[model samples]
Target: MAYPFKEILQRFWGYTSFRDLQEDIIESVYLKKDTLGLMPTGGGKSITFQVPALAMDGICIVVTPLIALMKDQVHNLLKKGIKAAAIYSGMRREEIAITLDNCIYGNYKFLYLSPERLETELFLSKLAHLNVSFITVDEAHCISQWGYDFRPSYLNVGNIRKLKPNCPVLALTATATLLVVDDIQEKLGFSKKNVFRKSFKRENLAYKVEYSENKFNRLVELLVQHSGSGIVYVRNRKMTKELAEFLTRNEIPASFYHAGLDSFVKDKRQKAWTENKSRIMVSTNAFGMGIDKPDVRIVVHFDIPDSPEAYFQEAGRAGRDGEPATALLLYSKTDVSNLKKSFTNAFPEKRFIRTVYHHLMNYLQVAIEDGIGRTFDFELGKFCKAFALNVVQANNALNILERSGLIQNTDTRENNSRLYFLAGKEELFGFQNQRQEYEELIKTILRSYSGLFSSYVYISEQTIAGRTGLSNEQVYQYLVNLDKAGLVKYIPQKKTPTITLLKDRVPENIITISKSIYEEQQERMKRRVDAMLYYISSDIICRSQILLAYFGEKKSKPCKICDICTSNGQQKDLSGSIRKAVLDKLNRTGSTNINELIRDLTYDKEKSMEVIRFMADNGDILLEDKQIKINS
Candidate 1:
């Protein structure tokens, strides 16, 4: 039977056709086969699952690592009248329970969950009860160590097969190397027969690199020359703010985006940029995922990214509408040093990792097996002050721990709320009955949550404490005691996001810096920088050919519209007459001062400088200070 995907596509998303590779990926998943999708950033990845899920009978579960993206996708689906929901780190227990129940019994077609949620018994058990048709892992490259952004939570996805032995898996990413692709397939348990990939080539984007002493002025010139909307990517949050301010002061309509901004501000700025209310956005890497703006004409990288994967993904954000667009990178020699510093900052010393791990375990007051589903309020500065560890070292250790998968880290800006049953309730409660104190808490929860017996509801702990006339501490103690009893669930209200380390402690002997890994990363970084430099320095190759080759494609000729190709024909006329005069002078004298050479030839100082610069750039002549030598 045909999956009726075409009909579903029109009925739901109102698209008359599938964008390239969407149909193939959808067909693969619909047949209960595994797939690896390598579509570029704006290539309609969501439709690959959304259309197929509508045709299937059971729920399609999407595992995403980004909380903001989860919410955005869920909201979009909900607006389209599709039954969709998400469970993320900051949600209350009742909220999660209700969303899960909706998936089990309601007409929900898609359910989204954070990768970190997969480790919980509560989630795993409830997930087993749901009739899930398929599992889609977004940003699938994160499962591989070779990927630019590797998350430890992504590693836990291999266990999903244990829960649903036969569910087809679909892995998706915008950018992945051969190593990352292989790692994703192996980690996700996809059979060789099931793997699928699209080529990583964007033909319409014109790649150019300008080699000038002043890149900032070059950027301003390009922005003024370009017609449509644009994006400028910087490596740090501080640069995002500063560059956006600088452009605004210069009267360009621009805004800045980064993770440090409040959600409300970020959302407002993002919307303004998306809707074209703002012509350009200056941002850190935080700005691009799930963004659907199709007419971005230019994408400029002010600083080099650490790897090619990150560079491709960020640059791919441009030219989605398919009209001619430019991807430019402004890199200097210092960018390499900056990138090395960033890598070191991202992975700290193993001793620091162990210290942070112990501190977290002590703060939570629980052993390894007992801490699942428990939430803790974490303040990094306070922890650093108490432990006497450098803040940078502590933060890096926390990052490594999170990567190791010992805990769930919630990094959202919203404050989370904690809830537990006033007394134990029986029917809704499943799992975690192993402890006795939890049984009493479940009893208390049952009596307390009257509405929970029938349906999910949010109740404030203060209200329960008020009714019981217990002090806040006593209420919390009883809740913790009940949580230990497994009768009532307790969720701690998180004011800030916590970073969960994958390991309780770093191994003493483990090498954080290996020569091989360092060399490999250095090579990847060098490729990106070289590509940028090639765009700036190459005069013979077509700008398009250079760019296409970087993404693993080969084009035969230059794009006629690029500055070099367009100027080539006219350049001969201007250079022919000047070349004759220069050659005659060179024949008369072996070498001469540039001023004397120009004066003898009657060329203006500006024209003399231009000719020398071009010759030096193209390697036809060598210049050292005022002296010039013709190449033999």
Candidate 2:
């Protein structure tokens, strides 16, 4: 009994055919074989697992480290009438439990969770109860130690095989080295070695690196040259706003984006950029994941990225529509040392790490042998000010602890106010009858929102207040009161990062940064920094080749469209060789077809055309009826 996969594609996506290698990967998963798919950044990686999972009988479990991607995909799937849910950092334990239970009983088609969730005791306890079709790992390179963005939490993605032994795994990544490829397959416990690769080449996208002292002018020049939608990636939140303002001052339509912005604002600005209402978006690296804008004509890096993988993925955002575009990097003097300093700041001394951990525990008020499974909102600026610590080093230390799996400090995420009715309708009616004072608010809530009884649903206190003629504070109090009465579980909206204690708090001396998380990881960061430095400084190698080789594409030919090749083009002596050959051919034949002459020339075809254009411009040749003739 097989489902019509092609019909499923048309029914869901309204597509006549699959993109390159999508069908094969889908077919491979349908056969229940573990697979590693290396797709380009904009390649349709989601379709591989989605089509197959929809055809299969049970829910598909998708694991990814990016919360933005989880929310984006879940929202999109829900819009398509596909039952989906997401569990990631910052979600309440109750919400996670409810979502997992729904996945078990509600006939959901997809459940997206972060890799860290896989190792949680709650998730582990519920694993055996799920009727899973398969597990899909996005950004699978994180599981490999050799990968640039390795996370110890990602290791637990492999442990699921023990519970769902027959559920095949599909791992997808935009970029991976040969070593990473093998490591991913082994770590995931693939039954046999199988890899599906889409070429990383972007023929229409040109990669460029520019060196100039006046960076702002260069940026303006680029914007003027390429008249279309673009992205400008900087290094910090401040830079995003400043650059965007500057661009706007220069008469360029621009907006800024970063994680710190309110969720509504972020969505609004992202929408503006996507719809071409804003011609340019100046942002930090947080802006690009899970966005589906295809006509991006250019992506400019105002500052260098940390690793080749990061750079490649960011730059690859352009030319997504298979049209001509440019990925330009502006290199400056200070960037090199700044990147090197970042590596040192990323791995503080072991003693300092322990010190930071102790201070964090004190800040969160977690006593020894306690605090496990509890989450506290962590404000870095406040904590650093309190401890008189360097913000950069303190942040790095927190990351180290997170990688060590002692705690989880995630990025700032926004959660809307949500509530779930714990009691059935009859019980709620009885409770409302008893509590007549809350009757109006309850009725308004029931009229305004749906799905509260079955699961959590977004609720707005202000909107409820407007409708009920009550103050916003009054509405909030009523919701809290209802939660306290055990009739509802209500959580207020928040935009803060939360640090969850993964293990029991211990004395400062007991905190140990393992070698894998510290020393070796430092070496890896150094190598990445060095790779970035080498990429910008070296002028002879094709930029594309350098990036491709870094990803284990050793046999790739030079792109010929990168900065190095074009620079070589400028220095190439086409006048001496191609010039005389064209003259001799024209003199012998008197005149020849311009295409035929360049096609017949043995020299480089592009160089030959350049020489022909030079002759035509300098009055050395005559063009008539698509033929070339020497000036008489």
Candidate 3:
């Protein structure tokens, strides 16, 4: 029963012990049992599968929804000398083929692919050939329409059980409600007895909400006062850019990131922020999925998120290094209105969905059956123009279609080529000798790469362009020409996450409403608003205690560092008689001013206010203007 996990840990990652539930998860996988991991952000979720993959007999297949996360995890695994490879949209075809071939030949221990990519014949065929030990689905809540970040592709995970019936499945996510947890198990086809859940709580983060008319100004003051890396999340791309600009104008080194940015630019900005070249990043929800920057001191939400699940996940990103961190939300009545507007925008009418569905089919020039394995470039504006549909309606329809799973949208900057040499060193040298014009380029590539001969490599075309003094386009074309000349094989890269809708374009009348989906989204929003209100109104509970309880954890005492616990010196727990006296004055006097109430009660002003607040919190008093009234 003994394994070399400890040796594997020390030899590769230089770690000695497992974090929280990682060892338990690894053990479960080893025992061929299903597991559901609910570790918080920065809890080392990656190691749960990684250690097990190394210890198991066959390759582990990880299905993730984020392309950025897949690439980052694969890169880190390779750095540790683990045989891991990821098949994502931005990779060239030859690279994918080589990686798939490696899996088929048992040369890789872990294979990461997008859940959307599971339907492809090429991937499925090769996957059938490989002996997969277990399947791990990250962000498992996305499978349920009730989840905050629902995706239709996640529904295909159940089919993995059909493909490899003997293999167990592990579902992992940071946030999920009781209902979401149930749906994930059902949707992923896990047996009832196999599910395992860890507590979802972090004790180090202090959560608080500030109510103010001028939230931006408040944010600036807080940023200037707080020292360390921070993130400010806005709801839209425009706000992300504007807030970052405002912060920079105020002399805070800041950057902005969103899905709308070009990949290269997004990569650069993310690198700058992660490396501490920028201390702050104002971003939309798209920014933090795969990022693991540990020492974040604060997380501010300029606008409320759509649901509590999202809010908890984003807030959990703070204080990951276990030092005390602050989670602040600047709340205004307008944020609630804006959030309602967003919900309407996300869920459109059925006619609109059909219109956009037809447009997409026509734009791609494919029939229903033929579209399953097809991939195409998508232009939102062009498609809208062609159908004479409003841009918002058209975009929302496409999103619905993507959620349903019909077509794959490969959105990227432009078409580009990449090369992966197929020959051994001696054969490559022979080819280079015959093709003398390309000798410098070949040598440059070889010098820049570390394991070019034995492993599948990711050479930066930008670096090759720099060394050869050629435009990126020129370098790409040269690589394609070399492939045609049989010097090396090449494939064009795809840049977007492959999106496939499960059903073809159906009529508006045929679309069925899932009450669970609607109710779930509504409840999610309610939970977030409740959390915001809780942080602002609570007086006796510690800020950290409130947050931890929301995430399903209990703490016996306050953390002492939070605003409530720290202010204990200035305040005392009022006696029940004093609380009743405060309520009685409010009820008898009816709308009297605060100063008059203090005088009438014959109590000090500070203690009187504290008693009034305590009565209000206990639902024994209602405050209006400066006066308080007892509940009827």
Candidate 4:
């Protein structure tokens, strides 16, 4: 039987049709079948579960790792008159209780939450009470150790399934290898044959890898050539700012986005870019998830990503509107060497990992067998400075600990600003009269927000600024003043990561990092780096084909628009010119060295070398180290 899902999709998302496997996945879920969806980024992954949940009988519980994305989806659903809520880390116990209770009693159609919440006793207690229709796991690849971004918390999803034994499950991921796909299904408890995978091919997106020494100049040229909104992905937060500033100085309307920025600033920058106030976003990998902007004509990787899965997802952010688009990866020999070194550095010694753990316990003043299940505001830089530890090594050590399930780290930028009024309305009356300076601000707060006296409320300074006609800074100052005056208890927004101890502090000698697991993870990472390097240096295969093959798809035809295919034509023409020049010069000089030919050529030395190497490899010439001779 056909459901009214098309009508529902139109009502909520205003889309007339579902993309690729969306309708099939939705149908399977609505029919109560365990399903796994493998759609590329921007392939309407949310609609598969959301539309079905809307058509189903009870609330759908969405498990995702991204807390901000969870809240964003809930907010969007609420705006469309669909009751939805999310519970994540940093939320008060009371808030979580209320949200879970609402899911049980308030007829909420959706309850989005992080996978970490599944293991909590409170969530487990409420899980038995929720009238769960189905469970949707986004970023399903994270459950597998083989996946590019593994999260140990996702392992608890199986526990959730035990609570609601009969509820069907839908696992969603944008990029997953064959290994990850099988792992997700097994981990999620798929009942039977239930996998829906769309091809990883994006026909309209031309994947290009260009060798360029001057990346910034090439970036400007590409941005000018492709006249539309785009994303420039860089490796580090500092580079995001620097590259964005450089682009702006070169007259490109650009803004930088990273997890380090205040939530309000991040939102403002994102909004400006999304609305076309800025034509480009220079960002870290954190910027792309759940962003629905279409018509992005280009996506340039300023630095190579850690894996092909990550690269595919990041590049897939372009051309969502289905128009022609370019995904350009700037390549250099230096990038490859540096990336390998960085990966090596990212995995510190096992002894170093244990030492960092010891120092972390000491830094937080936690004694052995104490501080279990406690969350602390952890600043890596501060901890490193205090303990005389290298920041990079410390970070890697923390990651190893996290992978070992010793601790959990939450970036506090993901935490929302919270406020609570300490004084009741009547009690504030005297203070309001005494301090006329804060009277209007206090009045505006009371008028605009609800339940400020009862609990700490998640507040948006931007919303307050709009309501009170004050700048965000001014609004923050007012909250700080209220806190200082003892009229309110305000927690200003956090920009550092929060570390939560999953288990009690143990003896440093007792801590263990699994040798097999560590080796396996390193091998996987090495394979990914090799794949990315192969994509960069390969001139024979289609760029799109290489990506497709990496994801376990075979026999993909060449995308004619990619650099490899297009350059194939130019390469032939350029090969003829270079061959003649080299032959002409060789004949005149009677087999000179390679360096002399390079000096004699008017073309770029790099291009000249590449041409000479290509000719030698193809048997038109013979290269013996520094010497070049025409093959007899």
Candidate 5:
């Protein structure tokens, strides 16, 4: 099948040429084959499907769980003169029906929706009438039980493929293990294992790990030395701020980001960090999923990540512009201990999981076989306080329930306040004149914004308040009154977690959390944790090779720039065995007196002392009084 891909790219994206494997992946899909494209974080994964869908004859159905991403892409596509529509939770039934009707009649080239939407009777009944050129499964890793961040909703995509059997499926993911790769293909029912992978090797990004006694000082020294835009990843919201302030105290301009922040604050801080107004961004893993600022010089992990997939995805954010960058992990013994505890907390017992599910249903007041298509704003702190549940354990149980397909909670809250005029201009004018009380607010809104009658427009409460000389709270009340009066359709701004029930509330006993969802996933987490543990401890292989081999790449050349490779010469002289033996003993046992450790080494006394001194100087070991210990 011949495609005018270059013309489409030039016309819409203004790209003169396609990146490494993009054209090939697009061609394979264009030829009506089930194709999986494994691209890294910065790889042009979207273009593989979008360009081909545009070149084809019909609309492309995109299934993804990221509502924010769907809206963003649909908006960008519309800006490029390509009609696109997105259907997700929180939309009124009438609004969804209108969108589906538009897709059936209008020649929209793209229809982006959540995976849960595919099985809806409304969507399925309309599916037969629409010409779907292809199906694009974004974040395709979620279909695999072994993949990090698995979502049960993604499994329904195959059923949709069976309905549109002629339409090819293009699965795209940023990170996947070998197990996840095969699982994705099998679960998606591929005709054959036709996969296109852009190599995961980032030559410009050097991977490094350090065992340090004082990680904070080490972090500061790294930032001082590197001197460019970098990210420091900590574990929780509180730590993000503390570390960012720590960096600032040391004269490093920094910002912090987490899911808990207000949407406007998030945007402001993110813009500052990305535009180089802030030299460092100390954040949780929540930051940097879809952000596309290349040329990041370094990424510092203050704590260890459980999975290599996550580590790779987060670390890949650096060196995206192909310049020299470094991914540095600073770990201590405490961090390793914390990571193990986290693994246990991430998968609670099945009975406890069931109990949490029951409590969750009760808390939401969802009756059995009811509220299947409903969405409720969820606040973790409030729920935990009411149930007296440990925040971490309860949150983990909810995730397990989500993986079991009972409900889904997108932990991030978004969207600003939106208003749409329900009554026409004449009717609104007459009501405002008669009501008299709502006159100024109505006039203020009418003069301040456009498109109120046509569609939903994002309106800021603060902006409205400033203009009308009313407090923000008062403005909110007035908007609610107007909504009740049928003068406008108002959706107040939300920054709370939202849970969407995918299935009717079932009894806790009947909720079957599958072995694949629980046991195998637990085992997968253990493997990822072990691999990460080994990656830090191993000195015989290059750091990059350890990460690459984890993702199924073997026989890659050593990146002579990584910590292991760069230190090889010293290791050759001092004997890597000496460094390995000292660390191994410490890991097995606790801190040992320096005299006893030296005696146990069995090497020449002076040589043993030399190795110990080298380690201590490199910040890998610490000595207090006469006792010696591994730094982390």
Candidate 6:
């Protein structure tokens, strides 16, 4: 029998009821059915699987592509007193082996892992021993080629399903079109067509578009007017820093975030913002996944997003607590033109793509038919410098190579430093006493960590430094000295992207680009870009309606709080009615003096002149020689 889900939710999460379709999704998964859930951002997606996992008899395996997300979920679960563990890239073999063994014997309820780990021998060997309740795939849209941010690694999810055929599958995503929806179902080996989707209409959030020549000034004005925590999204890393600095100069408590920052710095900045130490986070798209701060009053897009899906997901980050919030997009005509140019740069010419392919092989020192299944620490700037290639075009070519299955690039977070004793306790004691300088550091390491004698352990240099009253650099140097003396073996942390060769290198002439597939993807991208551009350029259409209709909601009502709706509503007030009446009289009489119109219409003379002035400014009428005439 299943556990009481409502009781668990209240006991663990302190919620009285599930939001939207969350209860239904949990029930479907509890009944051992394959399900797909399309919940918008902050739709409580984690609970759909998390609550079910708690009520089940065995563990649930969660597969995702983002290491940060996996770590965050695991951390949150642990804080809730739920037993969870995760295995990701950059972990040692011994550590992974021990983690997998714990799942079998330690009664761990959840095991989070990346899709690449599914193809490993260690994981496959341990797959049959433990019972799995269900399989949850987060960010399921990546399985579809039609979706933005596609990852080929996500395709391995189907293989995991085959290993645990009895277990159900629950797939979740924040944004997906009809095409992507169908593709996810087929790719993930869904048992049947079981899907639960929440409506994408955010009634309480106002979507606003501002056209401005000086965007920085307008941004500052908006921030001052709307007082609350917020996020300002820029396009590149440099912009993240520059904008954050600009906000600070204006007296706003702000900081910048990007993927290139160190892991410790990222954690510190994110914590400060989450706790309200900082009022705003100016960042790239790398920020704001799995963030639980609910009172973000605004989300500003300083740069135009590449697609509507990305825009909707990022904009939906606001108003998670269900209070009133706003999603503001600030852009100019020049920005739109630049976006068009970027689209061309995003997919370079076929010849250029092939050139990048050859150059990458040479850069990595891989000969033809060699370097299969090898991972390299790749630096994009270094590669571009070595070949004299344009950075934008070069990165786009790398993306094309990834889509073509030539290589895979993963942005890995830095792992913590690791070390273990190479000598026995007696030998280490003798050495430490003989050296006299290393005794305190050795004792501190022993107190902070255990079981280091037989296996390598993840250790924090900062923690050790604090305990021993030494600097982190001193601690690191002492560890290196110990390693050189054969008292310990140390592995410093790694903090760079890993590029893996999927297939053996082939000659540039034999490289194949599927014409139909390429053309179809290009066409789909064009439509998405066009839709985003339309959202920015349109002034008369409801912003909410466009977003809703794009996500397959064909009959959504206009959100009356959007910029367009608000403007149109304001134009229909009493003044607007009076203006229409005055226009009618003028059209009939051809022209009229102010005093004559006021006397004939018998309306308020001051209000009448105000309406006339508004009309004249908006090009509805012309006032020449004190006569009001409608403009032709």
Cα deviation at 567, candidate 1, in Å, is: 7.4
lDDT of 3 at 318: 93
Across residues 1-632, which tens digit of lDDT does each residue of candidate 1 receive? 65698999898788888888899999999888988888878889999999889888899999998877876787678667787877877676666787788789887899888887787667877987899889999999888866767776787788987789789998998877666778899999887745555656566776665555576777788899987899999978898888888888888889999876765567778989989999989998889999998899999988866665677788889989988888877767677566657666755555666667777777656575455556676778887888787887677676655555555566656332335344433433543355444344445545654334323333345555556656657667866775686544666544476654344433334525443334454454455555454455555445555444554443234456555555657543454456567767777787889888887776555655655555554455678887887777
Top TM-score model? 4
Clash counts per candidate, in order, are 29, 0, 7, 0, 1, 0
**Cand. 5 TM to true fold:** 0.84
Question: Using TM-score as the measure, what is the rank order of every candidate, best first?
Answer: 4, 2, 5, 6, 3, 1
Poorly placed runs, candidate 1 (over 4 Å): 211-216, 358-373, 385-393, 414-495, 501-632
Query: Which regions of candidate 2 fall more than 4 Å away from where they truly are?
Result: 1-3, 421-450, 458-488, 568-632
Whole-model lDDT per candidate: 0.71, 0.86, 0.73, 0.85, 0.85, 0.85
| Candidate 3 residue-wise lDDT, 1-632, digit = tens | 88777777777788999887888888898888888888777788888888888888899999997766876777678777777777755554556777798777847898888887687667887877898989999998888876767887777788878989889888898887666778888887776645556655556777766777888888899999889999999988898989998899998899999877765577778999999999999998888987889999999999876666777789888999989898887878787677667667766776667667766666667664554444555667777788888887677666655655554554443223335677778887887898787777788877765444444665557667788887778777777777787767666555544434444544435655454444455566555666655555556555665555555454334566666666745432443345656767666676667667778776566656755654555455677787666677
lDDT of 2 by residue, 1-632 (tens): 56577899999999989999999999999989999899998899999999999999999999988877777787678768888888877778889899889888999999999888898889988888888999999999999888899888889988888789999999999989888999999999999999999878788888888877788988998899998999999999999999999999999999999988866578779999999999999999998998889999999999889998999999999989989899999967787678777888899999999999999999999999998888888889999999999999999999999888899887655555778999888988998899898889998998877567877765667778889999989998999999999999998877678898999999989877788888888888888888888678755556776677677665566677877777756433343567789999989999999999988899777667755764664467898788999997
TM-score of each: 0.72, 0.84, 0.81, 0.85, 0.84, 0.83
| Inter-residue clash pairs, candidate 4 | none
Candidate 1 — number of clashing residue pairs?
29
Candidate 4 Cα outliers beyond 4 Å, as residue runs: 419-457, 471-491, 568-632
Candidate 5 accuracy as lDDT? 0.85
* Cα displacement (Å) at residue 236, model 3: 2.7
Q: What is the overall TM-score of model 6 with all chains considered together? A: 0.83
Best by lDDT: 2
